[model samples]
Target chain A: MISSLTQAERGAAMLITLSGMVAGLAMAAAGRGDPMGAHGWIVLAFFALFFGLLVRAAYETEAPEDRSLAYYDDPTKVGILIALAWAVIAMGMGLWVAAQLAWPDLRFDAAWSGFGRLRPVHTSGVIFGFGGNALIATSFHIMQRTSRARMPGQVAPWFVLFGFNLFCLIAASGYLMGVTQSKEYAEPEWYADIWLVVVWVVYFVLYIRTLARRREPHIYVANWYYLAFILVVAVLHIVNNLAVPASWTGAKSYSAFSGVQDAMTQWWYGHNAVAFFLTSGFLGMLYYFLPKRAGRPIYSYRLSILSFWGITFFYIWAGSHHLHYTALPHWVQTLGMTFSVMLLVPSWASAGNALMTLNGAWRKVRDDATLRFMMVAAVFYGLSTFEGSFMAIRPVNGLSHYTDWTIGHVHAGAMGWVALITFGAIYALVPGLWRRETIYSWKAVEWHFWLALAGTVIYVFAMWNSGIIQGLMWRTYGESGTLLYSFTDSLVAMHPYYVARAFGGLLFVTGAIIGAWNVVMTIRHVPRQIPAQDRPTTPKTMEPALPAAE
Target chain B: MEISHELFVGFSKSFGLFYLIALSVGITLYAFWPSLAGRFDKAAKSILDDEDGPCR
Candidate 1:
């Protein structure tokens, strides 16, 4: 019976299984005096049923291909869209939060509007929502592209996307509702964490099966980064987020680790989260789209290999740098510092390789906004990595730690490196995937490039200067050896920088809106047709051919 | 008072010596291990090779 059913039918069966599990868990939790547990179970059930219905509906009918390319199987396109959308939202939220830091009274005291509440929303939105989506989308795309295989299942692709978004929704909502494990990065309550694990497992399975069916003899460099991302994240999530909720309706939970150990584990997961989610995933995008957009082969394939290994080995140890001068053992701090410094070499190697790929393609950088985005991203990647390494040093950490300087460094990577590369990939993909010959406006692309770049520079530099001044003020002592400036004094000093940062954010958001508009016009106004010749003969090395410049 | 101070100093010196020896050995192993630097070089080359040329 299962064999006779269509792909969509098979998906429905899995969803049914999920629903049953959720119902069972809920019933079990209801037996206890835990309202939170009951609520969690019900939420799980709702998702399962929703997915089940979707599967059933999908199996009952076939989609019209001419309407829009079902890019689920085309990992590259899917990855690009996911990355871009999340990057926009992430950066937007980040700027909002930055503004809040500048003027804490900016937002009216709505339950979800407060900085304490929305900060996690912004962080998770960017890190997991934007960053995580980027990893999954790129990994899927890279995996399929490198493997020379279509994605494994029709429903499976939707499962990854929808399930992931569902989890993000739950986590973000839970934060506002005051349901949390109270962990720094892993703030989602036990139920949300459990749901994520299930979603992640499906993601892993989808990637593995797709890879298994690959036509290519060997996987690409991007695939390695994606695989490492999936594997490391799975391990990290399970280990750090081990917790038990107090009750079902209660948003409280307890971690397995206590005191110093908890602190260590949190940073371990936190910093690596930045590494795998933000760095590794964007590196995958950089490797694949940079060369592809530039129409050039990578500069040195050997350098990519060394950098990957170097980053993987060194980054895990460097998480301790976040705990510099903490109660954590001094030896651990030393190790973190050492590894962080060493990381600079590999990080620079990848950045250098990306830059060099444009050796003969300088004209493309001039004409193609996509290539320009990628190039700018590469420069930011270099800057962020250098700043990160410097901050990991104990002496430097003493000054920059817990300051806006750290915030500046992060945005430099997120906005400048990750978001820029994501935008480039999206611009390159939008026209081709939607069957448009050209973007609605080349001028808009150029406008976005300059505006966003200027915004990023203004935002980062302002934070950097303010952070250093704040750090200095905090450290400065009077002749009597007492503290020179009060904490609020630093806030007063930051007002001008904060206003500049807000202006920069506004510019960046404007650029994003322009981009979104360009994409919409390309999708709607542009004509769509799959020319008979453009269809793949056997699905090996097939891509939509670029139209000649008009 | 002088004799007691000398004996206490001698005990501290012995412990420091053992710690230094252990530290040196650990450093030596980290420097020599193929897992540390060699693997990084190899991984870097592999990725770069896949990029500029055909995947192996």
Candidate 2:
């Protein structure tokens, strides 16, 4: 199998195999001590030799025409399939956890099934698996479309997909096994972290090589956001995960930073992971798909440049706000709060720009379900950014910091913003890529929109009320000025909100299922052929022509 | 103590007024300058058109 791999594929597979084998040997040798280190070295050496042979064999085959668009469509379709599947899994797990919170008995007595493990699982699944796949798939498609070039290699795209899913599996399983660094978002152990590093480096190279071969005079704004996401995420991942595992299988690791410094580093990684992974990557999608769907030029190109710089400069400092009122220095907290407030300007700028792109296209907003999804996503993006700034304020943090209000705030971005934009992009992609006239049911799309919108509203509002109630009850004093309520009182107060949240989650999940079915029927029933002369031609002024259909 | 606190509050409020005016002017200039320059260029072109005198 390795012998049939291309250079990029072989490089990726070798890195995975070498890292696994080295880690395995390291565990075994550490148990035995002395002279066993050489044995571990020998195993790595053999894999390295095998890797070289695979590369040679891979190069011996006759190379396919590098200019053809045939390879682009296949990988792009695979990415879409992977993204849709991950969306279901991620959202399903999210609803399950929501139910668990609503009724503690829903956990079913399994250790791994509890909210403790499932919380991270829900977060990582949606953020990394669902949202990350959307970013990769859309970036690949948009990059190819904007650059007007074929992707670099046939086999390399498959490597990225397989390697990424494999890393997700490792991270998810490690969370269940209790193999964590005890960090909030960076919980994956050393082994999984290193796996991501290798995958990301290949992704970076793939992006750069394709961009180098572009046929367009000016790179689209979407590509800039995608490239920024890829570059900044790589830096953040390496910095935050600089740790030494006690042993390969020990399930423990020590980060390089300690004390307050460690707290700072963790939030730095945490917040930027949201920035680059969640915010910037999805901004790339918004930049490309929103305008295309609306059939309008972007509202302002200059606003995009200003927003890009503003988000980059301010977001890095805003991480410290997450550690507010902690042992972190007071000045750091003030800096964080100030920058977070500043971040609102840029976030709103992009949101306003997206909304304004639909100025003359409001008919589509009423008619096209896809445009509605994107428009709602922009609205939620504005809402979430404002909420984020508010939560960063010291006084607000006192009440809402540890409450379900924060949970509602996060899902507003993830489910309402990111997932909605992704769905719109995918809806647009399916008809174009698969040559479908229309989806199976416009009625189903309408159902999905209402169900999800209602669910998000019910979920966020319940949490807001519950959060404030809990905050007030906790701070209340008796007639004699003694503490009025026990800590458990707040938990009791949250029960109704938790139940409402689960109901909201159920509606959202139902909508997702409807969407998945709609996509499936469209793919299965739609015709594949477009008449030769009737096919759309690539615009000469924008990008080079695609390869003639075989 | 109350009188001194009130006096300090009055001083702070006046200083805040000054800060807000300066900030508003700065933002207005930043937003409008580029558009103003574009208008100036358009005006200059019209003047050149008049100087060239009904060429056809």
Candidate 3:
């Protein structure tokens, strides 16, 4: 990795690392008495280690090949490996969290081991750590190929990838140390949030720079989604994480908004994080990889346009639905419900477009596990969006709010749609990035597909049953019209479902382990091969294609 | 000359709805415009040519 960089780039990287080391040391000194000090030490150690490695490789010569002739992919490779590692760790945390709910005695007598602290670790780790890395990696790969241009800078890509991982590390470690801002998805404290802002700005600049240099006259459909994901997520993260830290040296901070405003702001950030982060970005992956793997074009360019703009417009208003039946005004809630239901139109349009693209490629879907992952993901995307719109209705929210039913709904999207699509993209990506003909074991992928599908089914069904039962029991009344079931009654009822959920999580994580091992073995054992038509230096005479609407 | 909180809310309540509706319509018109079909088709088929590597 170090040898690939020119000497000048290496010098610049060293300077950046040195500055980061200084910042870490200052934080450690300033926050000496608090948990913030420990975090400061972690940041210091991380940068120091990188700086040492860079210094060790300072005498190494630059690679002879012209980097601009080829797409820069070293960072994407590292990002994928990092993402898979996070997948195993975070999903394992999720499984542990599930088991604790089933058998409350599953934890040690430690604050970090308790449900409250560990739950956010699982949530943020999977969503931001695993999911965020996958988006960044695949976005890099997809953006370059679709545009036919190299990333504009060498160090900037590495900075973005590693800086983002630094932020994720701080976030996961902070939760274990009880250093949260207490917001749901936006949990890391003020300093960590600030770091992410820096990383994200660089990421956005890098993306636009590459897009600006595209050989194609028209930008691909996938680039639009990736750009939206990068651009909108920055706005959401900045606006939602606005806070006043009590002391710069301490971890505690107060939100800028309070009461109902705070609730609205949090969900707006939260739900759109779902919309843009989880939904749009993965849709970018689906748009590119699914069709590429299937040897087909996207079915409808017009529908793609409609879904892109519709989702961008409609999903923003739908955030208020998360605050239903609360201190929020009814009109706002109604508006949220209205848009959420309307959102189903474009959501299904995209999903249907994907399935329709597979019309002639059904044989591939039958045989190829990687393509099957994407197929099942689209089905889940359609199912969950319908479920989401239904649950957002005021009357339906009444039964679902604060119940395990909400949890069930989340896993349907998270496990079924988000995770399945990510795994599929990874399987598609790994062989290509490494220049291998195919994966090490097709049987493992087949096993993984069945395991993952069965796991998601078992998980979603268990949640549905438990959630409905819990919701009904809580609302139940006896002859005197008083509530019949005690709160413990719901807890007892949840025990069996919790066990099932944990078992499902185990299967999913097991598949992930298998997938990760397959990747490692493929990288180590597979013979290197290059494509005949794929060399970056090849000259092309094809005309650049433009979009119709543009 | 200050825009008070309630005033802003009321303005948004009335104006935001119509503005969003207009935007949605505009997007729809742009997407379905007949002239774009040729370009869109070409663009869709554009990615099919790239396999196993970056486009040249």
Candidate 4:
């Protein structure tokens, strides 16, 4: 990675690394005898390790090659590897958490290993660690390809990738250290949030700089979604994390908003994090990789534009649906519900656009495990979005809210749509990125696909069953007009389902491990040969004469 | 004029509703504009022929 950089960029990297080390040292000194101090030591070690590498590489002579002749794929390559690593680690944490629930005594005798702490570790690890890394890596690949322009700077992409991972590291570690802001998704405290803002701004700037130099006059639809993902996520992160640290050196902080206002802001940030972070960014992947792999153009370009705008507009208002029947204003809740229901139009439109793009490619979908992953992802995207809209209605929310139903719904989207699409994209990208003819083993790909599908189906079904039963049991009335079942009774009833859920999670994690192994084997064994016509080209000024379809 | 809750709700109930409706219509129209269809189609197919390396 260091060998690819010009001497100037290497010098800049050293300077940045040095500054990061100093900051970490300062934090370590200031927050002594605290968890923040431990985090500071971690940060120092992290940058220090990088600094050591940078120093060792500093002696090497730089190669004189035109940097713009190839896409900056080193960061993307590293980012994908890091993402797969996090998928194994974090999804393994997910399985552990699930097991802990089924067998409550399954944890170690330590505060860090407790359910409350490890739960967020599992969450932030998967969401921000695995999912976030995938988005960043894929975005880098997609943005460059779609624009047909090289990334404006070499150092900035590295900065964004590593810097973002630093933030993820701090987040996952903080959760284990019992440090949090106690918010659902925005749990990372003030310092980590601030660090992410710095990283995110650089990411945004990198995107815009590349786009500004695009050879294509028309920005593709994928770039639009990616831009939205970056831009809106920054807004959400900053607004939701508006907090005052109890001490400048400590991890503890107080939120700017109070009570219902805090609830509203949190969910707004929370749900939109889902919208922009999970859905939109992955949708960007879906747009680019799905069609590219199928060797087909999008079915309706106009529908793509329509759905893009529709989702952008509708999803913002839909966050309040999470606040339904809460202390939040009834009207606001209704507004959220209304927009969430309206959101289905664009959601389905995009899903339909994807499926319709596969019209003549049905054979590919049938035969190719990678394509089937994407196909099933689109179906799940449609399914979960419909379920989301249905659940947002107040009466439905009354049953689904605080139940495992919400968990089922989220995983249906996360595992089914987001994770599946990511795996599909990764499989589609791997051989190409590595300059291999094809994957090392097609059988492994097929195995991973079926394993992932079975795991997701089993997990979702178990959650749905447990959720509805729990929701019903809670509301059930005896003849004496009392609750029919105690909470313990419900817990007892849920034991079997919990075991099933954990078993399903174990299967999912096993599939991810297999996928990771396959990736490694492919990289190791596959012979290197660049595909023909796989190089970027200069823009053609002359407009092509074509026959209009409509 | 002072911005009060009453004023905000009343304005939103009337003007906000109309404005959103208008905006939605405008976006829909912009997406479906007959002349722009070809441009959109071009955008869709533009990246299909992308190569792995940057322009030399």
Candidate 5:
């Protein structure tokens, strides 16, 4: 069975096994005493060995000449599954942490289970793992199809995919083990950060080379957005993660930045991670899938180009808005706030472009769950971006910052826009990648849509009201000029809202489960009987294997 | 090389902002450039041209 794969597949399989062996050895050395470490090595050993065997077991096949003509890849297939799996985990983590806040006893006395540790897991898991994989999978699919050319080489995409996921593993496991720099979103210690840097560089090179191979006259506007996302994210990851490790094993590290510089650096990394990682990449998905699904032309092709450059230029400087009223220079804070406000222009441009593109396609939007997901995602994109700019102003930040209001804002974007759009992209891709007519069940897609909608609405509104009440309570004063309400009073008030938020999260995860079911069933339905008639003699044996008649 | 710190900062603050604004405006104009309307229209519908079959 192993003999059927191309030379590249076999080479990749062997490389994966060797890397696992090296990981296992490293784990034995570093985790010499810790079960977590020992367990990590053992898992790597098994994972590598299993994949090696699986690759070896794959039935060998010779590709027909027509197969290489247009480049579509299965890395995307693996990517969407990883994205859904991460969504389930990250949403679960979000729910657990929210519960812990409502009832502190939920920590269960395990240090790793404590809110402090798991919070990073929730953030990193959703942002990098879930969002990152969706971007990777969709970008590869788009690049190949839009360019009308194969990726320059095959193994690089897999290397970037697996390598990035490996870094996600290191980051998550390290956080639980108390190995972190404690920098908001850049929490992974120096080693994990470095590994990500390497993976990101490979991703960038692969993108550029693929674009270089494009037969299309103009690199579709979608590829441009995806490319900008790759390029900007690479720069941000490297600069923000510059750190000195205490040991060679990379379990701990110190930032190259310090004092206000460190704070600024961290938030710069934090916000742009939102910008480039979440916004930019997903916008790439929107550009392609929204138009394709809406059965409409992009409302304005030029607007996309303008918005792309506008966002790329302005977003880099807006990170300092997270540092308002800090020790950072007043001028810098003002500059950050200015850029943050200006960002609304391009953001709306992108959002409006998408919404306008759906102008004539509202009937399709009504009928198609996948298109509805994209359309609603566009609306949330507009809504959250408007809110983001409002919060950046120090006066507004004064009330909203350090409250569940901020949490609500983040989730509105994360849950509403990011996850929703990813589902849309995956829904569009699943049938195409597997060469099926459509999903196994549009009924499930409809279920996911409403469940996700109800959850987001409940989660966000509950937080908004709770946050405003908490902020108002914290500031209430008596005639005696003494504070009228203690912090605990606000906590007591927030109790019910916390419960609602947790319940909202439960709904979110349930929707994701439905989505996962939809994805798996769709893939399973794609016919796979072609290899048995492996002898390629025009259409003699192949004709009957085709699912066209179905 | 001999520029004062304030001068350098001022230059960056003013020139950089202006350059970006100009570039953004330029791209927007170019996109809506009347002559390019047909090209943009075709590009918008490019996903459907000459496909092997219905991708449905």
Candidate 6:
């Protein structure tokens, strides 16, 4: 009976199972006196019925007439749309909360609206919600296209999608309620972390399974990077999040390490999160999309492979750069700084290859806003990597460590590199997946391009100005051998730059909104009817050709 | 020294350094080897084999 159903129906049933179990857990956790218990039981019962109906629906639906027609699964299309929704939510909150720096008067009476809580919501939401979903969705899409195999199957893919989002949901709600584990980028509590582990392991298996089924003799370059991303993230997440729960039922947990050891573990995880999550996965995207859009292969396959291993091996050592001025040993800090400097070579190898792929296609780069987004993203990748290497130097880090300069550097990377490449890849993928002939509006793409460019410029400038000013003011010594400026004096001086930073953020949010609208319209678009001149000409004769002229 | 952060940091000075250098050199040699060029080329082209031209 189950064999009679389609993959889509099976996917729907899997969602039912996932939701039902989660609802059951919520009800169990609620206990008797909890105010949410009534609501929990209701949701649980709803899921139970929903599960039954989904199963019934699956049994009734007919399987596809041709097995070959459904070779690739498409949960990615749904994942992409949801990723856009998250990007909007994440950036919207980011702008609102950031504006509060200039107008701290925007403060709300509610605890959830506090800048402290909203900051995590913005970080995690963008990194995980926006960026994570894009990585998963694009990885699934690129994995299938490269491997020439169906997705690992219907139910498992849905499990990954639904389960990962469940983790995101728990994380967001938990933060609002003040239930974090207090580790930046690793803040989700023990249960959420464990659930992410399960979801990620399944994702790894699914990727390996797809590769094993490939029609080609060799796995592609993109798959190698994607695999590194998945495996290393799992390692990083588990090692960084080792903690003992205060109790079985409560959301509180304590890290396994304390003092300087804890700080070391956190930065190791933090900087590498930038390494793996921000860099590696998007390098996978860059490998696929840039070449495909430019209608050329990467300039040097050898460089990519060398760089791939180079980045993976070196990024692990560079995390201690985040701990330079801290209690971490001088030798350890030197090791990190040295490897970080070494990293620039490999990082640029990939970034340079992306640009070189477009070498003969400069005309295409000029004309296409999509390609321009990608090209600029590569340039920023090169620029930011160079910046990171120098910034890791002890003297440079000493001056820049805790200033808004660090914020400037981060936005250069986050706004400039990570977000741009993701945007470029999305623009390329949407039309292909949505079965549209072109974007619903190229005008919107152009608008998005300028808006994002302007926003990033304004943001970087404002932060750089404010950060350098803050650093110099704080360090300035009076001729009397006394500190020149009070700490509050720096804050007073920073208000204008804060307002400018907020303005930049608003502009970025606007660009993202425009991008979201363009994508939505494109997805809803019907394929245009090609006019006679526009359509490819068909051969007039229907005569069968003789086989070989025999 | 015990098997601890202190011990590990001490060990990392030489052992960790050599391990990474070795890994980098090994990967570089493997990537640039003459015999594997054809395989790399095939992998590069694999993403294009099933293309139906971007639904456009």
Q: What's the lDDT for candidate 2?
A: 0.75
Q: Residue A249 in model 6: shift from native, Å?
A: 1.2
Question: What are the per-residue Cα lDDT tens digits for candidate 6 across A1-550?
Answer: 3453466656666576766668556755653443234334544554565466566676464644433234443678878888889899999888988788888878766888888888888889989998899999999888867755555446667668766876787777667767687888998888778879999999999888767655556777888888888999999999999999786556668999998789889888998899999999999999999988888888888899989988998898898898887888888899899999999999999899999999999999989999889998999899889989989999888888888888888888888888889999999888877667899899889888888888888988998899889989988999999999999999999999999999998888899999999999887765744322211112122221111111
Per model, the share of native interface contacts recovered reads 0.02, 0.00, 0.68, 0.82, 0.37, 0.51
Q: What's the lDDT of the predicted structure labeled candidate 6?
A: 0.80
Model 4 Cα lDDT, one tens digit per residue, B1-56: 99987887789689978977888899889988999877788778776778644433
lDDT of 3 at B55: 41
Tens digits of lDDT, candidate 4, A1-550: 7887777778889999999999999989998988789889988998999899989988887765554456778888899999999999999999999999998887878889999999998888889999999999999998888878667657899899999999989998989889989999888889999999999999999998777767776899998999999999999999999999999878899999999989999999998999999999999999998998888998888888888888998898889999888888788899899999999999999899999999999999999999999999999999999999999999999988898999999999989999999999999999998988789899999988988999999999999999999999999999999999999999999999999999888888899999999999999999998777554445332321111110
Compared with the true structure, what per-residue lDDT tens digits does model 5 show for residues A1-550? 2443355565666776677667667766776655436445754765576576756665555342343433546678888899889988888899999889888999999989988899999999999889999999999888867655566545677778877888888778877877678888888766567668888899988888767665556778888888888888888888888988776543567789999989998888788889988899899999999998887878888889889888888898898888878898888888889999999999999999999999988899999999999999999999999999999998888788788999999999999999999999889888767767678999999999999988998999999999899888877899999999999899999999999999899898899999998899888875532222111122222122122322
Could you give candidate 1's per-residue lDDT for residues A431-539 as a string of tens digits? 7665677888889899999988998999899889989999999999999999999998988999999888888888887788788777777777877755332221144
Model 2 chain A: lowest-lDDT 10 consecutive positions: A531-540
Highest-DockQ candidate = 4
RMSD of 1: 8.1
Docking class of 2: incorrect
The regions of model 1 sitting more than 4 angstroms off are A1-88, A529-550, B1-56
What lDDT does each candidate get? 0.73, 0.75, 0.89, 0.89, 0.81, 0.80
In candidate 3, what are the lDDT values of residues A455-531, reduced to their tens digit? Answer: 88999999999999998999999999999999999999999999999999999999999999999999999888776
- 1 versus 5: better TM-score goes to: 5
Q: What is the number of residue pairs that collide in model 4? A: 2
For candidate 2, lDDT tens digit of each residue in A1-550? 3433345555566676566566646744663442224334444454455556555566565343333323266666767777778778778888899888777888999988878888788788888888888788888887766665667654566567666776676677666655568887788777668878988998898888777766554567788899989999999999999998776545468999999989999998888888889999899899888887887767766677668767876788789998888998786788789889989998999999999989999999999988899999999999999999999998898888877788888888887898889888888787667767777788988898888788888888887888888878878999999989998988988899989988988888788888888888888986675423211113333323332331
User: Which segments of candidate 3 are over 4 A away from where they belong?
Assistant: A535-550, B1-5, B52-56
True contacts kept of 1: 0.02
Show what share of the native A-B interface contacts model 3 retains. 0.68
Q: List the candidates' TM-scores in order.
A: 0.82, 0.81, 0.96, 0.96, 0.91, 0.90
Which DockQ value does candidate 5 get?
0.38
